[model samples]
Target: MLKKYKDDQEFYSLVGIKPQTFYKMLEILKIAESKQKYYGGRKNKIVIEGRLLMTL
Candidate 1:
C-alpha cells in the first residue's frame, strides 16, 4: 500500500514527477475531475485534492 499524501508537493515526491510533468500527467490521465464528470467516474476517486477519501 502507498502512504497518503496531503499536498501536491508531497504527492510529486512520492510519484517522482516534476511540477510541469505532474500537471501534464494529470491532464493526460483524465483522473483529476471537473464538476460535470464527477459523478460519471465515481469509482475512480483519486487523492489529488487533499481529501481523506477511501473506498469501502
Candidate 2:
C-alpha cells in the first residue's frame, strides 16, 4: 500500500510530478475513487489546501 504523503512537495518528490500536474491527477483520482482523500487537521474539515495529495 502507498503511504499517505505529508504534503505536495513530498508527493511530488515521490511521484516526480509538478504541482499543477499533481492537482490534475488528484482530480482524476477523486473522480475514479481509487484513492482516498482527506482534509488535514483535527477539526474544521476543509479540503486540505496547499498540502493536498493522495495515497494508495
TM-score on alpha carbons, each prediction: 0.33, 0.35
lDDT of each: 0.52, 0.56
Please list all clashing residue pairs in model 2, or write none if there are none: none
Candidate 1's clash total is 0
| Model 1 alpha-carbon drift over 4 Å, by segment | 1-14, 31-42, 47-56
lDDT, residue 17, candidate 1: 62
* lDDT tens digits by residue: candidate 1, 1-56: 34556876987666666556655655644554565476675654455422322211
lDDT of 2 by residue, 1-56 (tens): 23677887987786678667866766765564433325333442444332354342
Segments of candidate 2 deviating more than 4 angstroms: 1-15, 34-56
Q: Give RMSD to native, each candidate.
A: 7.8, 9.9
Whole-model lDDT for model 1 versus the true structure? 0.52
